[model samples]
Target: MGKFFYARVSSKDQNLARQIEAFKKMGAADEQIVCDKESGKNFNRENYKALKSALGLRAGDVLIVKELDRFGRNKQEILKELEYWKKREIRVMVIDIPTTMIDIPKGQEWIMEMINNILIEVLSSIAEQERDKIRQRQREGIDCMPVKNGKKVSTKTGRPVGRPEIKKPNNWSENYEKWVKGEITAKKAMENCKLKRSSFYKLVNEE
Candidate 1:
């Protein structure tokens, strides 16, 4: 029976060092290691498909993964693959789920199978549920984007949330212009402009 190991990461930028190290620790040869740097949300993994086809699995062959999530994040998909492999008489060994190891004696295969089934059900359910929760949180966050770049966001109105546009004095510019053109004294400009000293200076400098 052939021993093969699988590893995965959700994205290309994600570090694969840890998973590769785990495979090495398990004595998986360089060629025995197959990795997919893609989402575990579905089975649309290229290297994963290649691994299956390349191995041409048969009875007694084993497929190993560092963890259950590395195998899949969807409950239905993970369960489906598990049953598929089982039917083909190929054992799936997950490092974290010790019960899945194929090293057990032939006589104890049934017991290990039962235990692995139970673990798979529980772990896969939790994985899928956690993934759903994370997606929900992400949707809610991006939907509203509570705060962005230190400014509260308003996706609906396309404005800063809770902050209204500043309304400058109606004739501040006219008065400032008059002051600049020497038509009005600084004191008169300040009186007519209806702006604080800092604001008047700020607007003047801005122009």
Candidate 2:
């Protein structure tokens, strides 16, 4: 039986040093540990998939993670993965969940299983809820951003925050005046301004 460790962080900018150190402290060799700097929302991470490959884990082998959420943040998906490991007889030991780290006597294994299930259920739910709260906060922050003309603007600089607004062509005023007097078609005005249909319409609608 082999022991394998997995570590994860939400983004490439985040550090995996702490989790790696924890694994090393537990006597896990570098080669036995795989780390992924990817979101915990899904199991589609590269290093994570490599760790779960057939050649990596096997029956009676142990898979260790620093925390339950390090395994994943989606509660249902996390539970599904745990069921997969259980069916394959691969032990998953989460360091933060102490009950998962204990070895149970053969006959009373159910007791440990029950306790571990309850703990995992609660922790995974919390993890997923935390992810949701983070996303909600991000949306709120974006929503609170000041809008300028027709775009979101930075409160500090009063400049657009997202895609830059398309500039009006130099001849826009002349052509727009002609179009307003019914002397030129809107399409003809757009052609004269050298702007695309959507760009011309967008500029026209902007105050």
Per-candidate local distance difference test: 0.82, 0.90
TM-score of each: 0.67, 0.74
The regions of model 1 sitting more than 4 angstroms off are 146-207
Worst 10 residues of 2 by lDDT: 47-56
The regions of model 2 sitting more than 4 angstroms off are: 153-207
Q: How close is candidate 1 to the true structure, as a TM-score?
A: 0.67
Model 1 residue 112 lDDT? 82
Task: State the lDDT of candidate 2 residue by residue for 68-183, as single tens digits.
Answer: 98899999999999998899999999999988898888899999999999999999999999999999997897799987788888778888887666998888889888988999
Candidate 1, lDDT over the whole model: 0.82
Candidate 2 clash figure, as a count: 0
